[model samples]
Target: MADFTYVSTWRGFVYVAFIIDVFAGYIVGWRVSSSMETTFVLDALEQALWARQPSGTVHHSDKGSQYVSLAYTQRLKEAGLLASTGSTGDSYDNAMAESINGLYKAEVIHRKSWKNRTEVELATLTWVDWYNNRRLLERLGHIPPAEAEKLIMLPSETMIWQPEFTDKTLSRKPGAVQTGFTRHAVSWGVCHPNIYYFHNLTPGWVSFNGEKPEIAIVPQSLHRLIYGPDKRSSPSLDDDLVVNLCTSEHLLVHHPMLEGILLSECERLKQHSLANKLISLFRQFGGTELRLKLVWLCWLDLMTGNSLDDWTKNLKHKSEKDLEQWIIARQGQSEPLTNLMDQYVLMAYRTSVDAAHS
Candidate 1:
């Protein structure tokens, strides 16, 4: 879908609209556009009707001007399909379609940097194919829509097992007990010595046998004492300590000395101010990597520079393309730059020094 959009950019701004079958969740019709004109949506709807040839199906949508247009209405009437528009502000009416748009934004547009419309169109084609044939649908029981439909067409039978349990007896012993409810005897093994026993206490229950149950009971107030609030949710030593140790050892082996380097670099960057020099260096390098490195360098530089203070504080108000342009400009170039990484680092160091004094 992104590729389609990119390719369409060669001509002008374009939007790709599709009519997906609610039952099968397959895109039955889609059309690319250089404009949001009614024709684009109408063409898409026509394609959908022609492909599906549905005798009668509810064509549901929000009260978008395009869908409400005379030409769009005529096409639906001629095809004998019901045109249903949800209330003006009700999102539920067109939630499924909206979700499709959200998915396209998150999974495709968010991830890539496209040069043109042609690229967007091509990417869109690949995305659509994967979505239809490969993507799993939770609504369809974690099966792809096409596969789930196939299964539904051919019914099958299989056996399923379920287990049920009930208490057989309840008895107590003499003063081996501690209280009316003997702490030790209340346990399954102590209460019913002959029967196979199991612990059926609630999650926070405590036991103090010669073999201590591997459960820690920490008071809510004292939670910070052991793990602190942030680390409290982490697995305790009793929970898979061996597995945790093994994972730690494996990580160390796989990336030997990486942690030390990371720590040293962090400490060094913290003490060193290189904000202006970093930004200038980034401007010199100009590219994706250079852009990111510039951002980091800029942070350090800002820490030391009075003039460049809070430069990006209002960045949230900027458009995405504007932000990209700003990043590119900081690198002192734009896309299609060469030897970007080295240039970026050098420029960053220089800029940081300049900004610090300025």
Candidate 2:
């Protein structure tokens, strides 16, 4: 005995319905939508039938227009799946589906905000994957749906062993350049700088310079190849060159390999310079605006310096708090400071949400 579940996300609104098997808490079907369309419910029912392939499984949902639509009823008859609709305004009739919906909102939707249809779609996909594969359902004896399915399929096989392997190798070419470099890397040192030129050497199977010539030896397999490093131990010349060439703006705009190493070094020095400037400005009776601007600039520098999506989201969160605290803690904080902070907080929150949804 199994049940089918249909859930819809209508412009951020979600509706979940299920038909239960009294004997077994098996979920046979589910659907999702961003609208209160009959198609959504129908799709879910169709999917459930596909899942169970049970010749006369009862499909049940609330008395929504979508469920009562001619097309929906026709489809159910065509498939030979029994259709059952709950009585009007009877909460108990659709309790199971409502419970599933409540769980979905509490566990997934309420935790974050979605920006658009695409974002909602992606989030729904992730939620479904988690629910079906990772979630521990108490009804299923605290096992994931997929795991439970496996157990049923291979009851005699007590232990399902999955072999895993790891390859410690970089996925990309050793020295691949970032795309869109021309638009953003004009002031950067290695916009189009040749790695061969940086090394001041002709392409060949040789290690012409270093403390240990043999140790620094260029592997024949790697030499003369555009994206190859001499060996795993040797620095990736192209990536290194890009790092050395990166200015602050360049680093902010381009996602180059080794950018993190270069930006970290740049930031260490920039932080000292900024500290000195701030101290000097404070001594010189700088206005609040100037101090605030400098603070934001430093925050932006740190955010862009990291160049990773997760780090940027974290920086956004920290910056929002930092600005608020800076204004409150500072002695001469102005009214305009509050407005400025509001603008940044909103923007950061939006960006963070977008990044998460993305």
Candidate 3:
């Protein structure tokens, strides 16, 4: 959903409009203006349209006058986009957009002072670049939004976070980011044994998460670790075969056999600063083996129920336009967003399990 927030500057108050791609939480389009005119929202929409060239994309927003204007509606219709507005007095209806607005406020507007529209615009441009390209998001598996979209299934140079075994464990390297855990998360580029297994099995390279060319661990390996090496067709290896994190040293060490641990951890620790860091390292095992494609499905389901058909079966190849319609339908639903998100994750887990077995 799209919404504009007011920014205070020496020149006056400028409004900022943002159109976010709910899939990876990327701000696809944005505009900063001194006025809350329809043109402001329209310009943002035009930029998004031009960048994505999307057809049947849903544009959801609050019942603001600018969003409901004739000019905006006409533009959406002409571009083959659908417009959806929340009901009166319902903040949760446009919760996702509002959440973005809240983040922009906390991270940029509230933290820094602005001189004029030019300054705000420049800052926003920089922030968007950082947010999409470098910022690690827990929802997207501790990867940036752009990296999620440009996913290389078999990454040539993949970085793994080697967890410190205990507080007494000597540091092999300096920590990149402080995650407030007992053990500081360290990133390493060395080839782990799991990488070699995939390299040998698939040969050249394959999409572990179905995002071609990017190296990611498929559910089969996760199954081997979570269940047992002999549980599947793969040859039995030591306990360290997969990036097993559920040992006595980690937070989730007790819940080794947990299903949907990734999604559950998200709901459990959504507000924790160190949540993403912990999750990215821990989700490699159990039934919650995280992947970008499955996370994208959770995003779609979070936005709206039944927006995309369950890919566990026949309708696995739905188009983008159909996905957009699902978002529009979701905005109009009376059901809770959390329930929908859970349902989608469940469906994704089942589908992934089936795919791994096949």
Per-model TM-score on C-alpha atoms: 0.40, 0.37, 0.45
What lDDT is obtained when candidate 1 is compared to the true structure? 0.42
Residue 126 of model 2, lDDT score: 75
Ranking by TM-score: 3, 1, 2
TM value for model 1: 0.40
Report RMSD for candidate 1: 26.0
Q: Best candidate, lDDT-wise? A: 3
TM-score: which is higher, 2 or 3? 3
When 1 and 3 are scored with lDDT, the better candidate is 3
Clashes of each: 38, 16, 10
lDDT of each: 0.42, 0.41, 0.49
Candidate 3 deviates by what RMSD? 16.2
Taking the tens digit of each residue's C-alpha lDDT, what string does model 3 give over 1-358? 5788999999899999998865556788999998888999999988888877765445667778887787887787788665666656666556667777887888888987789999999989888888878988775579897886564222422322222222221122111111111111001101112222211110011121233232112223222322333333222222222221211222322221122233323333232332343344233322332332344333333222332224333223434455445444643453443343344344333212111121
In candidate 2, how many Å is residue 84 off?
A: 1.6
lDDT for 231 in candidate 1 is 45
